[model samples]
Target: MGYALTFEGLRDLAEGAAVLGTGGGGDPYIGRLLVEQQLKAGRTVTIIDAAELPDDALVIPSAMMGAPTVFIEKLPSGAGNIAALRALEAHLGRTAAATMPIECGGLNSMMPLLLGAQLGLPVVDADGMGRAFPELQMETFAVYGVSGSPMAIASDHGDTGIINATDNRRMEWLARAMTIQMGGASYISDYPMDAATVRRTAVPGTLTLARRLGAALRQARAEHADPFQALAAALSGTLYTHGLVLFRGKVTDVDRKTVDGFARGHVTLADLADPRDQLEITFQNEHLVARRNGRVVAIVPDLICTLNSETGTPVTTEALSYGQRLTVFAISTPDLMRTPDALDCFGPTAFGLADPYTPVEHLTAVP
Candidate 1:
């Protein structure tokens, strides 16, 4: 089924996307504001299930590529993504039938929505990554053999470039360099594919899922219920079934820096009661690994999300600071993302961790 996104729905979607962001994917608040600008201008965004897209329809994924830390300080001009989309369309010599998110996390999740509203194109209810990943080549679209180039990138100043790389990895390398040159952030349109390809490779219903998750959190707060428990119950009916609180504490230390066009760093949290009990999360733009007192509690390919302890609002990696009370939540990734090929792209080892890939369910099991 297809539906039109309302202002209220966008709020829920952004909130949910932040949770799914796993502490990366730029900032959802910024993304939401971008979309809100379009809506306020009388533009509307229509979301349709991937199944509703004709097999021949061309789908382009839109996103911002760069260090989230820099993105916050250097806001987008809002013209970059549209310019990138236009440049890509010119390169392909065909208008896109629809636009979708390369990843369903944080700011990227709303990129397609903004594009769709601005261009009056339907937004697909799917995305390449169910959650956020650091690098462009880490998407399922690439994992399942979709080429990321010929892709187009645009800067806030209207500067644009196109890359036709030999492979997705090379595409990512090239784009990363260009993004850094664009002042640490650039808008991009990549992995232009037909609807059938998107349907087969992309994670389905993620936009809907995000909206549901946000609604669940909002409703839980309204009812004076535990938001985490509400979130878990919400996940029970979705493809991502297991949601658990891995740790609850206050951020004690943060060692983050932007390098190679990524926010690469780690944050340490101390238990509210036992200061000796600690949790450390390492990241490259997104939360990749969570360690509790020197032991691995949750790892990549799984969703490790940091949220406000009382409000259940997601806190991005760039926003993590000392003395903030936070809850580290972990959710299982879909089986598609757990496949060997998927792991090869975003596994713990892929992030240079010695810990082997283990399902969150198994890692947090009670003995």
Candidate 2:
């Protein structure tokens, strides 16, 4: 069964998407407001489970490209989303039977939902990354052998272009170039595939997972229970099942900069109970690494997120501050991301870090 998306429903999805985004994925608030505007305008968004899609169905994966911070200064044109979707449909010579998110984090998590609601289409309850990533080529679709193009990029200014690349890697290369020329941020649609390929490549149920997790947090808050515990319980069996609270602390420092069209930065949290036990996080749009007490604890593919220690609201990289009290947690990534090929493409090495990849389960293992 599918659920209709509403403003109240968005709170759950936003909170859950924030957890999935892992300190990246642009601000969920912005995506929620944008979508709420459409909903208020009478657009209805229905979330469909991946299992409901027929094997022969045509599915399109959609997302936002470029810097998340850019969207803050320059709002999205809104029309760019369906413009790219329709353009891709034209290129494929087939209308999308349904659409799905490229990732279940940040803005792209809701981008497809917005497109689905506006187009009066259903959004598959799955996504490429169960969590968010910075680059396009790191998706489950790309690692699983889906071609990234023929793709489309569109802007609110009536600017649109279609691109055809031979491989996923080249598709990102070409799209990055076009995104910069058009503006810093734009909507992208690509990796069109049949439902069979999608079932194999996509992170099934992540959209609904995001919503449920969001709802869990909301319910916990309303009931006056420990939201952090509720947060862990909500993710008990997903790919991110190995949930662990790394530390609760007050932010002590933040070093951030925008580089190569990405937000690259680090945040330091000093132990709230004891300043000596500290956690430091490094991010490239998404949180890539987490170190506790000067020992590496959580790395990429696994999830690393920081939430308001008291209220449990997520803090995005762009919204990070030095004085905020926060609780940091880690969860295991899907097994699909642990394979040799998947690791080679998205592991710590790909992010230019030298640490051999270690799962969070082992790092947080009890002695």
lDDT of 2 by residue, 110-199 (tens): 888888888998999888888999888888888898887888989778788888887777888888888877777888898899998999
Shift in Å, residue 261, candidate 1: 1.0
Model 2 per-residue lDDT at 164:
84
- Candidates in order have lDDT scores of 0.93, 0.86
* Model 2 alpha-carbon drift over 4 Å, by segment: none
* Ten residues in sequence with the least summed lDDT for candidate 1: 69-78
List the candidates' TM-scores in order.
0.99, 0.97
For residues 134-193, write the lDDT of model 1, one tens digit per residue. 999999999899999999999999899999999998999999999888888999999999
Best by lDDT: 1
